[model samples]
Target: MLMMPLEIFATVATGLGAGLALIIAIGAQNALVLRQGIRGEHVGLVVLVCMLSDIVLIAAGIFGIGAVITAAPAVVVVIRLAGAAFLIGYAVLAAKRAVHPGTLHASTQTGTMSRKAALITVLTLTWLNPHVYLDTVLLLGTLANQHGELRWWFGAGAALGSVVWFSALGFGAKLLRPVFAKPGAWRVLDGLIAAVMLFLGIKMALGV
Candidate 1:
């Protein structure tokens, strides 16, 4: 069935709003992206990776991959466990950074991450996050399917939301460089990151 123009617009708007609601939340992925953005380390690549990942996941959900995933409980269990461990480990690192806060000019603290390391870290943060699957694949997919023939249009809006959000977060973080120039700010940011990671890690571990 061909959706009317107004119907298409409404579907797209709904998808965009839903996507932003889920993606805008504070999570490990956003924390890492914001940190990399502020440090000016692989910001473009990181943002691209995040946007692409979301697009792929959204597409998967729209195409019925979510059902396959749901049928395979083992896969989720594995991902959840792995994600929990990785999150906890990352939390420890963030806590250490918080304890030993470094100034923005400190190359060892802010600018020394190799491109390869940055890429790997961002990938792990994105893929290992089970919440990404739940939000993008299952939830958004379900929502899009409700649009019937306009589902792809909904998915496109969701993808655009991902692009807009990551672009804003990754690029906009640089504006805070002045505040981060002080070691105190770094300490606070890292402390918050640590807390978020730890909380998520524990929750995932318990399957909550």
Candidate 2:
């Protein structure tokens, strides 16, 4: 089936809006990206990984992989429990950082993460979170299929949304470097990250 230009535009716009609405939320992934961006630590690689992950997930969802995953309740449970544990552990680390805040320079010196470590961390953050599967694979997949034959276009739009958002977040975080230069600012940011992670961890654990 052929779609009119207007139909394509509308479908893309809908996908873009839905994608942004889901991804723009404050979560572990966003927090890590923001921190990496502000610290000037492999921002491009981080953003690229995030973008590619989302694109792949969104594609999977649109292509019916979501249905296959959904058929296995055990898989979801395992992912949820594992995700909860990781988030909680990360929360503890964030709390420690909050307690002993460091200036941007001090962080750069003592907290510098190797590229391989950063890559692994970002990938873990992206893949370990069950919310990614829920949002990208199930929800977005369902939404895309609603577009019928234009489903791929919807997925493309959602993928573009991910690219736009992660690019903005990872690159734009440096603009706040001035504010984050102080130890107090680091404390506040880490405190918030810890709180968010803990809340999410607890929520996931309780299956709430």
lDDT value, residue 169 of candidate 1: 99
What would the TM-score be for candidate 2 when compared with the true structure?
A: 0.95
Expressed as tens digits, the lDDT of each residue in 37-96 for candidate 2 is 988899999999999999999999998888987898678788889889989998998898
Candidate 1 C-alpha lDDT tens digits along 1-208: 6568998888888889999999999999999999999988899999999999999999999999888888997898899999999999999988888887653342354546788988998899899988888879999999999988899999999998999999999999999998988778888998999999999999998989
lDDT of 2 at 33: 92
Q: After superposition, how far is residue 73 of candidate 1 from its true place, in Å?
A: 1.0
What lDDT does model 2 reach? 0.89
Top of the candidates by TM-score: 2
Cα error, residue 91 of model 2, in Å, equals: 0.9
Candidate 2 clashing pairs, residues 3+ apart or interchain: none
Candidate 2: residue 190 lDDT (0-100): 85
